[model samples]
Target: MEHTQDNGSVVYPDVKTDYHGHPNYFRVLIYLLVLLGLSLAVFEFNLPANVAIAIVFAVAVWKIGMVIRNFMHLRYEPILIWIAVFAAVFILLAFFWGVFPDVSMVHRELAPKL
Candidate 1:
């Protein structure tokens, strides 16, 4: 294949090539397996309510990281981007931490009245 370049020249072999020069079938299979494992974690584990919530949240976070790094192609993004993401995650976690106790207390108080 040939393509016109910015300098008005024809460049041969213009199509982008894979980094490894081959299809990554194994990687795709592994990603599918990981998703299956996450699904199984949700249904297979019989845990206490609080512990189940924590486990599901942790698995969701891990799956999100995998999607961001692999599917979104952000694995090689700049360190600044990683720092920003981490900062956002930390702030959100802090917010959740601050709100959870108050919410739990409110629910507990309401439980007895109902």
Candidate 2:
């Protein structure tokens, strides 16, 4: 519980601002930078284009998880929030998966040039 002093000043609980003065945050930033570097460095290996794209996507998903858990403060959130986020992602993927076949499979040309 917070209380007001005789001088009419309130003492508040822990407050987070801008992530300044936080060593862990700086570490996370460094880690993210490293991930970014690695993702960029993927191009140097001369891997197949599809393999490179897969690696980039895997790295991207990991980076997104890290950013959400650390930077967005979602790690401290409740389980329900994680469920909601996953549910939303699942629905989005479902929609895209459902549309992919139709979009990518076409045997006919709609109209020829005049």
Candidate 3:
């Protein structure tokens, strides 16, 4: 809801904004703490390297989302902004995909037996 002032400027009353307004800081802090704790737990288990990497990557993705939503105020943004962000992510993934096979193949074929 908005109210119009005598100067013809509009003021939003009930709408909550994140960046320039009050943010849900407590929730964000809780998420950060939880993710941090989980990351620190990575050394406790004797899981295989691949599984450990996957777990850490999952947590990292979640933490990134939380930071984007709360810290960057991306949750309140429009759909086009989301599309743009996703496009950037896709481009990054494509770059990594292009680089992965060469690295992996070289590592697999050229590794010296220990």
TM-score of each: 0.54, 0.72, 0.70
What tens digits encode model 1's per-residue C-alpha lDDT throughout 27-59? 745875787587567656777778877777787
Residue-by-residue lDDT tens digits, candidate 2, 30-90: 8889999989999899999999999999989999988888778777567998899999999
Give lDDT: candidate 2, residue 54. Answer: 95
Instruction: Please list the C-alpha lDDT of all candidates, in the order they appear.
Output: 0.66, 0.77, 0.79
> What are the per-model C-alpha RMSD values against the true structure?
8.6, 8.0, 7.2
lDDT of 3: 0.79
* Pairs that collide, model 3: none
Best by TM-score: 2
Error of 1 at 11 (Å): 16
Candidate 1 error regions (>4 Å):
1-29, 45-54, 110-114
Count clashing residue pairs in model 1: 0
**Decreasing lDDT order of the candidates:** 3, 2, 1
Top-lDDT structure, candidate number: 3
Q: What TM value does model 2 have?
A: 0.72
lDDT of 1 at 20: 14
Two-way lDDT contest, 1 vs 3, winner: 3
